[model samples]
Target: MKLFKNTFLSATLTGLLLAASWPTYGFPLLIFIAFIPLLMAEQNIRVSGTQKKLRVWANAYWAFLIWNLITTWWLINADLFGMLFANLVNTLLMSLLFLLYHSIAKRVNQILSLIFLITLWICFEKLHLIWDFSWPWLNLGNVFSDYPQWVQWYEFTGTFGGTLWIWIANAFGFYALVQNLSRKTAQFILIISIPLVLSLWMYTTYHSTGKTKEVIVLQPNVDPYKEKYAIPNLEVARGLLQQTDSLITPNTEYILAPETVLAQNLPFGNFEYSEVRSLLRDYIYLHPKAQFLWGIDSYDLVYDSKEVTPSSNFVRDNLWVNNYNAALFINRNPAYQKYLKSKLVVGIENLPYKPILEPLIGNLMIDLGGTISTKTTQKERSVFTGDDGTKVAPVICYESVYGEYVTGYVKNNAQFLAIITNDAWWSDTQGHKQHLSLAQLRAIETRRDIARSANTGISAFINQKGDIISRTQYNEKTALRGLVHLNDVKTFYVRFGDYIAYAALPVMIVLFLFGITRRKKSPSYYWPR
Candidate 1:
């Protein structure tokens, strides 16, 4: 009973440390040792020779539950059910990974067990990026986003490198604490210092010599619950034009508006007939040199003969339609292009396993006054080229959270990135702030400047080095104008993308197999009890 009590306390301490070390509020340095208490708790269970696997799993679940609830409790403002599902399900997944590590530890040596833990966690993060219920917002690598200068090397290894760095630091720190030896402690300090030193050196020496483009980002600040969908498309267009007229100059190359700024569902086939498009065309006529990128909720009709994908919404009379949360690019050219949002928010914009689960509890999900079904997506990443031959990638709201998804835009010759989002649905909470911070990681990984426009949230210009040059206050109707460097050079991460996680897949398999093949042994004390 005493041991169980101690274990629960240790778990709570681990969760508190992790929550207190997260971004937008906490110091990231605490993450270096955040997992030490939990590790110690597991070790104590193993050494006690009593219900080792069950105790470890229980303790891990408790720790992860506390961590998830504290760090992401703000999600409840968006949807109570979503918050509960995310917290409970994500904690279960994390605890399962730790349970796998505990099982492996009982069969292998300490070094192998540590390696297995790191590999499995990285793989889990990678899986989170592509799965239907993706929620990579809590990925360990993102903790350093508040301090971009400490992660300049993200240009090479992507966020997976940060994940690897944090795990290695925790392992060393845990070992040093258990051994209580001066040499081990010094080794832990050295491991933590080397990467930070290299990152600082790289940050100080790096320089941007690319061409500069003047960009204007608009934050309409229309309340999502009150004024956004309630207002007509023309009114929204007039508001955007007023903001643009105040901020845009002759040298301004691009004017960006936030996601779903045109709340009216425009038909994809008759986009030119939309009043918002007409207004934007007139605005572009006045500023002939400027290009406009804006977000729209659109739909396209399809007949019976047309092949339909999973996201297609069936209607009566042998007719079906595809709904898109998309970005529209307008210029002097008569024809405009649209890029549909590929990555979608679970339960809100997307229904996971729609064929199976939609029949179960689909009505519980909120539609936010747009499409009642899953959002349609394009297979290829599209880059919009201006009249002067400069290209910009239109990254819609939730899509910006994906690292490799943005790389595909760079690979298609996007010189800069424009992110348009409507974060008001989550209210003025950590949800919007954390979303804004993650864009800095994208800027670093692709080595491309970012013009981020958010409705009722943060609107800012981020440089190629992941520094915010200018920003607008949340919930304020304003516009941000700044110069963003246009880089043609691709970083290593942009070229290769999440190589660390990809490499870990086979290594994880090998380690798992090796552990299973080894003779099963009782837990031996790797640390003094």
Candidate 2:
């Protein structure tokens, strides 16, 4: 009973420490020692001289569930059932991975145990990034988002590097605490200090490389629930035009608006007859230099059988309609361009395991702002070409959260990053703030300037160093114009993409085999100094 009490206290401490290290309002430094308590508790259970394996999983689940609720409970604002499902399932996945680590540690010696733990965890993070049930919201590396000055070295390592850095620090701190080594402070200090030092140096010394262009980001502040669907698309466009007319200069190169701003659906093949298109065309005719990009609700009509896809929704016997939450970029040069959002929000934008689940629950789907069916996505990252040959990546709301996925734009010669989003779904919570902050990490990783336009969250310009240069207040109906650097350079991370996670996969495989084949080891050998 006493042992269980101690472990429970320790698990709670881990949960609080991690929550305290979160972005926007929390002190990020706490993440270094946050996991030490959980590690100590697990270690104590290993040497408790009893069968307490179940205790490890129970304690881990408690700690992780607490972390999830504290950080992301605002998801309840959108859908009550969705919030609970996300928290429960994500927590289950986290605890299950930790249980695998505990299982390997029971059989292997300390060095091999720790090796397997770190490697397997990295592999899990990689899976969370690209897998079918993709959700990377709480990936450990995101802790440094609010403090971009401390992780400026992300250009080379990306967020996976930060994940590896956090794990190593915790492992060393736990080991030092166990050994009571006052003399081993040097190694532990170096582990925590080196990344910050390098980051600061880079943050101070690095200069942005590229031409500067003027950008105007519009935050029309349309309430998604109340006014967004109520008003006509032409009314919204004219309102946005009034805001843009006040900000545009002779040199304004790009004008960006929020996601899904066009409430009226347009035919996918041709947008000539679209009412909002004519309103925007008149505005663009006046400003010849300004290229406009905004989000819209549109669809494709597939009459031919060969044109049908897995995501195409059936309208009748032979006709199929494919709805898209898409971005449209227009200029006088090539006329217009389009890119569909691919990385979808779990239940809101996409149905998980759609093929398998759609059969069981036919025609039952959740609709937020877009359609109920699964959104169609393109295989490649599409880049919108600027008027004067500057390449701009038109990243949609949820798509901006992906690191490697954004790099696909850089690979295709995107000189700058432009994000359009509607953030009123969660309404005045950490959801918008965290979403804005996560864009900072992408800026650091790609070494490119960013201009983010949110409907009611925030519209801002971020520099190459992940620093917010200019921003609008949340929920404000406003517009911001700033000079953003357009760069054609690619960082190591942009070229190689999550190399730290890549290096750990093979090592994890070897250690997993070793742990599985070896017999259970003595308590003394189960942990290392």
Candidate 3:
């Protein structure tokens, strides 16, 4: 009982440290040593060699649960059930990974065991990106988002690089402290310092030089709960236009509006006939040189002959249809291009394993005051080409969280990124703030200017270096006019795309096999009874 209490205390301390070092609040420096206490708890369990598995998992769960709750409790503002489900399930997944490492450590040398832990964690983060229940908000790489100058190197490695950096620093720092080796501790400091120094140097030296385009970003400040759906689409369109009319000039190359600015669900086939389209068409008629990109809730119905997809919703009379949370781009041409949001939020936008889980737990889907449906997505990462040959990546709300996923747009020749989101659903909580901060990482990774238009404020322009040039107040009805330089160059991260996580997969397999094959070893240190 005493041993359990000590381990539990250590785990809780670790969780506190982790939460205290997250972005949008707290110091990121603590992350270097955040995992030490939990690791010590796990080590104590392993050394004791009695009820090792159970104790390790339990301790890890406690730590992860506290961490999840502290950092993401704002989720409850959107959905109480979703908040609980995310915290419990994500913590369970993290604890299971740690438990796997604990099992591997028992049979292998300490160095190999550490390697397995690092690689396994990276693999887990990688899996989180691709999986149906992906919640990469706590991925260690994102810790540096609030301090973009410290992670200028993200342009080469992506967020996974930051994840690897954090893990390596924590592992080495923990080892040095455990063994009480001053020289090893110095080495850990050096390991942590080199990256910071390099990031600073790169941040100071880098500069963006290219054709500049003036952008006007709108924040409609429509309440998702009361005003968004209640107001007519034409009135919403007129409001957005009225806000941009004075701000936009002939030099205004792009006008960005928040996600679902047109709250009404328009049929994809007759999108041109919609009043929302007409308003935009009239605006484009006046400013023929300027391009407009805004979010819309759209749907399309397919007859019996049309092929059905996994996301298709079926109706009576052999009819199937799809609902899209999409970005519509209107240029001088009569035709407009649309990019459907691919990276759907777990319960709000998408139902994971829908063919199986929907029947069982479908009603549990949380309604965050937006279009709640199994949203359809497009396969291609579409880039919106402008009148002057410049291209912009139309990144929807949740899609901005994904690093490699956004790279697809840059790879397809997007010059800058335009992120449209409705962050009002979560209100004025850390949920929206964190979402805005994560976009900084994307800006640095892609090395492209970002024009973000949020529904309830935080509309801003981020430079190539991930610096917020100008921003509006939260929940404000305002518009931000700024000039974002258009660059044709692609960064190394955009070219390679999460290579660090991909490279870890093979190394993790090898380490896991080696750990399993090696003979069992006793700990070098003693555990307190």
Q: Using Cα atoms with residue i matched to residue i, what is each candidate's TM-score against the true structure?
A: 0.96, 0.97, 0.96
Runs of candidate 1 exceeding 4 Å displacement: 1-5, 359-364, 525-529
Taking every candidate in turn, the Cα RMSD to the unseen true structure, in Å, is: 1.9, 1.9, 2.2
Task: Identify the runs in model 3 with alpha carbons over 4 angstroms from their true place.
Answer: 1-5, 362-364, 524-529
Clashes of 2: 0
The Cα RMSD in angstroms, rounded to one decimal, for candidate 3 relative to the true structure is: 2.2
Look at candidate 1 and give me any clashing residue pairs.
none
Error of 2 at 371 (Å): 1.6
Worst 10 residues of 2 by lDDT: 362-371
- The residue pairs in collision within model 3 are none
Pick the lDDT winner. 3
Write candidate 2's Cα lDDT for 26-101 as tens digits.
9988999888888888888887766667888898899999899999999988888889988989889988887888
Q: What lDDT tens digits, residue by residue, belong to model 1 across residues 1-529? A: 2333488898998899899888888898899988888887887787776688888989999999998998899888877888999999999999999988888887887778898999999999999999888999889999988889999999999899999999998887766666665578777888788989998998888886579989999999988776777788899889888998897888998899999898877788877987777887888778887788999888988886467788877676778888899998888889998899999889887888777776787534565676667788889999999888888999998888889899999999999999999988778778889899999999989989999999987999988778888888888999989988788998899999989999999999999999888776665445444
Per-model lDDT: 0.87, 0.86, 0.88
